[model samples]
Target: MVKHGEEGLGFEIVKAVLNGDIIEPITFQKVKDYCSTSGIQATETHMRVILSNSTKNSHSPTYKNYFERVGKGEYRILSEHRRQEKYFWLNVDATSYEWSFSDLKVGRSQIYSNTNPNGAKRKKETCFKYIQIGDSVVAYETGTTKAITTICIVENKYELDDEIFIEFKKSVDYDLYLALESLKANGDLKDCDILKNHRGTLFELEKKHFDIIRRMLRTLNASGDNEQDLHEKVKQSLADGSDERRARLAKRDSVTPVSYETIVRVFKRNPDVIAEVLMRANGICEECLKPAPFYRKFDGTPYLEVHHRIRLADGGDDTVANTIALCPNCHREMHYG
Candidate 1:
């Protein structure tokens, strides 16, 4: 415990500075004024010494972390609690909007045409103004919100006489055409209320719920992509393909005719394992603690290859606990180092 005289003096001074103002971020002069009679004497050096002593003691209750330096010599009383920035999840009805998830499929444009509700096409009943750019959009089946079908990011909104035209930057649920039924098969859908009721609505969602959606979509899409890539690679290696590289490889072969054989093996890769490890690493190689060497050509996500700490060929299960994100150099080092 600190002694009660000069040793404990700065605590009172800090308290005065904190409670002195109606609002926080008070001027340093106000702090000094409020703290004038708390201690022995008032001089330029004494004031600096008290503040310096108080802030320097980080373990002390009157530490500088309790306050923030906003302006020159001005401090703000900072609250102890902090939270992430809020983002909203919006609900859009397929029946009301005259839209479908099919419109967001591969190679489709980013525009979505939403029709105005009957008798709601006037200048006064403009609730469509509630939606803004950068909000999330979720789709439900035509008549009910019992299930969420798709998700998209708002890009632009244009209002016309009988309809509202909304554009999306990209959709997380591109390949999903009415996914609610499948979701119901996995989990109970009766608990969703906001998802069932609103049209042109923006309701804030918890981070956990948002992550639930993101994880499902991210893993699903990545698995599909990896499967496609594997197929395309096999197809390119086959000499019968239309690709020029296959023909060139065939021509470059020696006089002993080589036979082509197709061997299909199941690639049991866990999408969630790779996705979670990469996200946790945040594009830095786990082995080197450096940023990835390059970005992916398709998406701008930093290219850190996922590796298994225990070799999969050695009977390791595909799981995040057994996986890591590493740059190409570190990955090669792991195998051949």
Candidate 2:
């Protein structure tokens, strides 16, 4: 029996080289060059399998239905027969496993078929075969955070030593973490496959639902705030009593350290304002009338922070009239309490 691996492999290679315009035909020589550079072994006969003429030479019906020969060694994908781009919800147990998302971000994650028993092995095989280039995947951390952590575009799929591996290119960073509850709350995703079942590691997500999720993530995580505004937002998130505390309590022992990239603003304050406020208050806190927490090691000056009556970002002046010196405890209470 013909392995038909060439047909599958050729189809993916052609798909990757397809231009968005689709008006231009892809030449066999171009495909060959790509295969040569990409380390894909292919013969002229296997290359012909990517065209419609291959149907007469081989029993493989896969690519035969999609590609049509427009000229000698030139092919154009059948516009009407092209497969639609697929969307997937892939569950990654990043909380339980270290460095999973980091590896996934670099397109090095493996889809292990031998990790589980019969049913899981079958599912892994199906997912490996089903996912193709141009597909979009939303990776969800299901072990602990229960949030959609990253969005990825499927770039390549191949088998090595009988094990399947997928290469993914991260399209967008869902750093804010679209929580499971937030997804469940969306009306369009309420009946989504993963939400309804939540059984397997991979599930087909509807394009409409995927679009909604993408839009929601991009909108919620949009940045352009002043440092004070950003700080206030962080405070608000911490003060949110909906489910944060409960979730933290449940994962007290299972908690693992994870790092995320974020853009933060560091305020550049007027030094004269701090010096004048400290001079006016001496070594006492303006708020609590208490002594400074300690003396600075370098200059032996009392350690105190100048508190702004109204934040500078909120139109407060950077002068002694608008600032006051406070000890560490009083400053902490002024900001946190």
Of candidate 2, the 10-residue stretch with the lowest lDDT total is: 256-265
Best by the TM-score measure = 2
Q: Model 2 reaches what TM-score against the true structure?
A: 0.45
| Segments in model 2 whose C-alpha atoms lie over 4 Å from true places | 1-82, 95-97, 102-125, 224-337
- Cα error, residue 217 of model 1, in Å, equals 2.1
Q: List the candidates' TM-scores in order.
A: 0.31, 0.45
Write model 2 residue lDDT over 154-231, tens digit each, in one string.
Answer: 765544444545666766644356777777777877778678666666677889989988887776677646434534
Top lDDT hit: 2
- Candidate 1 lowest-lDDT run of ten: 256-265
Q: Enumerate clash totals for all models, in the order shown.
A: 0, 0
RMSD of 1: 19.2
Q: Write the per-residue lDDT of candidate 1 for residues 239-299, one digit (tens) a residue.
A: 2333443344345533222222111112355444455566679879999999999986755
> Residue 276's C-alpha lDDT in candidate 2?
49
